[model samples]
Target: MLKTAGDRPYRGRLAPTPTGRLHLGHAATFLRAQERCQAADGTLIFRNEDLDPQRCRPEYAQDALDDLRWLGLRWSEGPDCGGPCGPYNQSERQPYYLEAWAKLRDAGVIYPCTRSRRELRERVAAPHEEDEEAEPLYPPEWRPAPGTGQDAQEPGEVNWRFRVPDGERISFEDELAGKQSFTAGQNFGDFLIWRRDGVPAYELSVVVDDLAMAITEVVRGADLIKSTARQLLIYRVLGAELTPRFAHCPLIRDEQGKRLAKRSDALSLRTLRERGLSPRQVQDMAR
Candidate 1:
C-alpha cells in the first residue's frame, strides 16, 4: 500500500511530462510547488510523467532534469534521486493505473468509447489559455452502455469513458483562484479515463498517482482547476476520505495573451539559458 501523510510531514511533487523541455510556464508552476513545499517544511518529490511512448523521449527527460537544476530548483526525491514511492516515473507505474482501472470497472463507472480521434478533433472546443486540451464533448445521445457496446473498434480495442453525472456542479475552493465551479453536462461531459492503446488517460493517471504519493497539496497551473474537479469525483468514488488542498498558480502567458505550449521552444529554459541568461534572470522573467 502507498504511504499516507500520517505522522510524516507534507509531500509535494514536480510532475513533468518529457514530451518537451521545461518552458517558462512550467518553471513558474514548478517554482510555486517548490515554494509551497518549502513553506510547509515538506519533502518535494519529482515524478516523471513519461506515459506517452511516442512523444516522451529519454533526452527530453534528461533536459528537463538539467533545466530544473539550471533554474536552481531542488527536490528531496525524484527519478534521478530515489524516493519511497520507488518507481518515480509514470511509464514504470502502469500496474498502479491498472489497479485503479479495476476498481472503477468494479464500480461500473467506466464504459468503452467508440468515437475515433479524428471525429472528436473536428468538433472539440478551441484551444484555451493554459487549460486542458478540450476533447469534443461526447454528445449525450452517442454515449454507449457500460462495458457492452463499442463505438467503432472491436470490444477492447475502443477507448474507455467515465460516466460524469449530468447537470451536477463540481465546486471547490482553490487556494489561489478562490471558489470555482463547473457544471457537468455543461462545462464538461463524459471524459476518457483510459485510452484504446492500453494506456491510462491523464485524468486517471494523475489522481491515482496523487493518492499513491499521498500528495497533501497540489500546486499546479490554474489551467488544471477543471482537472481538479474531475479528479475530485474520482477521489469520491475511490473512498478517499481526505483529498489534498488544491493551489492553482497563476499562468504565464505570452505577449499574444495565449498560454504557452511546449511548441514554443524560444521561450523554453534551454533556449533562455543558451542565450546567456542567468538563473536569477530566468526567475525574474518567469514572474
Candidate 2:
C-alpha cells in the first residue's frame, strides 16, 4: 500500500467493478488494501465502480459485499455507512464528474473530437512494415479547438479529449514498481474525457472520485499502472492535491500466465463457496 506523506492516517480504497462475481483476482487486491488499512489504523473505503449501467447489476454489487465479508474483509465506509465521501458508487456520483469536466474545460485542457471506434481502430492498424520507428497517428481533427464547447454537440458528433502537453514526461513513483514514467504526447495522444453519449470517461471519473473522497492511497492491480500518468494530468489540471502514492500489486494470473477473465469460473468466489471452500482457504490461495 502507498504510505501517506507524514503521520497522517492512511486512507485506502477497494473499488470493484460489479460487472461479474468477485473473483480470486479481486480477492487478492481487496485483501492487500484491507491489510494496509488495518496496519495503519486507517480507513478502507469500498467503492462500486458500476458506471456501465448496461452490465452492472444490483445483485452483483451485493454479491461483492457478501464475498468480501465472507473473506473477512471490512470497510470503514461504503454506500451503507453514509460516509463523508459518499455516493460510494460511481453511478451515483455523476455531478462530481460533471464538475471535473467543467474544470478541465475552464482550464483549456480539453476539447471535442469526432472519431468513431472504427476510425480509431483503423488508425491504430495502419501499416508500419519498416523497422524505423513511427509515432501512433491520431486523426488531425481529433484535437478539438479549445473553448469550442463542441462537447455539447449531438451524440456521435463529438467526444471530449484531454490535450496532452507535447514532449513532456508524466512520471510517478510506485511503492511496488519504483520509479515509473511515460511521455505525455508519445505514450498516449489526446484521450477521451467523455464519450459521445455524454458519460464521463473512466480516466476522468476515477480521478475526480479519488480527489473528492480524499483517498490517501490507491491499492489496485498492476494492469492500471499506465492510468496513473493520465490521472496525474487530471490532478494537475484541477489543481487538486498531488495523488496519493500508488501500490500496484501483482496481478493474479492463470497457469498459462494469462490474466484471469470474467469467464474464469474457477476463480469466482461464489463458485468456490458453492463447492464448500472456506474463506480462509480462498485467502490462502490468494496469498
Candidate 3:
C-alpha cells in the first residue's frame, strides 16, 4: 500500500448502502465529504456498500445516485462512471476480501467464532443512550481457543474474528472530531472480519476498500467512532501502508432528540423533493 512520490493525491468517497432512501444523515455526511475534498483540492469517488443481497436493491441504488445528483454532488469516479479501481460495489469486491482473509489467516491473528445473536445479547450489556447508540461491543470470552498459528481453522463455515490484545489502547486524531482514544478490551473485544453468511463484515470491507481505493479521508456519521476503533485494529494487524484520515459528521436527530432512522420518511430526500423543496432548501434544512 506504499505510495511513491507524486502517487498520492487527496481522494475521498461517499459509500451509500442501498437498504433505503438517502436520508438527511447521509446528506450531511456526503456534503461534508464534498466540501472537504474541494478544500483539499482532491478528487471524490462513489462506492456502493451493498454487501447484503437480501436488503440491497438496484432501485434503491439508482435513487441514491439521483438524490446525490439532485443535490449537485459530483464524483470523479463511481459505479455510474467506471474507475480504474471498480467495481465500486462492495459485493463485487469479494476477491480483495478473500485476499485479506488469507493474509489474516496466515498471520495467525484470526479465529473462527460460533457465537450467535442470542448468545451475544445475553452477554454484552447495552449502555443506555440519551439520544442514540452505536452497536454493542462483543465479549472476547465468546471466542474459541486463541489462534496460535496459521491454518488453525478449518475451511468449513464459521464467523472469522480478529484477535485483539487485552487492554490495548488505540488513539487516533480525526480531521473533524479531533483526538479520540479507546481501550480494546473495554471499548470492544475481538470482532468479526467475515460472517458465516459468506460476506466480509463492515469492519473488514471498509478498511480493505479505503486502502485499495486510495481513499484519503473517510467522512461518516459520528455514530461510527466505535467502528473506527475496530477498523483501526485491523489496519494495525495488516500493517496497512495507507490508512485514510477520518472525519465523522454530527448526526441528525428527531423531535425526541434521537438519531434518525431509515423509516423516518419525513426526513428522507425523496420526501423533501416531493414537497417542492429545492436543493438549496434541502441543504439549508440539513444544516
Name the better of 1 and 2 by TM-score. 1
Identify the runs in model 2 with alpha carbons over 4 angstroms from their true place: 1-6, 126-141, 150-157
Residue 78 in model 3: shift from native, Å?
Answer: 0.5
lDDT of 1 by residue, 1-287 (tens): 12224455788889999998889999999998888888889988999999989889999999999999999899978899898886899999988987887777777777777787677766665445345476656778777666553232322566888899888888877778999899878877788888888788999998999888888888898878888878887887887877777889888888899888888899999999999999999998887
For candidate 1, the C-alpha RMSD (Å) to the true structure equals 3.5
Give every collision pair in model 2. Answer: none
With candidate 2 superimposed using the best TM-score fit, by how many Å does residue 145's alpha carbon deviate from the native?
3.4
For 199-274, candidate 3 gives per-residue lDDT tens digits of: 8889999989988888888999998987888887788777776678888998999999888887889989999999
Expressed as tens digits, the lDDT of each residue in 149-203 for candidate 2 is 6344232445778888878898878888788989877776777778877677788
Can you give the TM-score per candidate against the true fold? 0.91, 0.90, 0.92
TM-score of candidate 1 on Cα atoms, chains taken together = 0.91
Q: Give the number of the best model, judged by TM-score.
A: 3
How much is the lDDT of residue 191 in candidate 1? 88
Comparing 1 with 2 on lDDT, the higher-scoring candidate is 1
The lDDT per prediction is 0.83, 0.80, 0.83
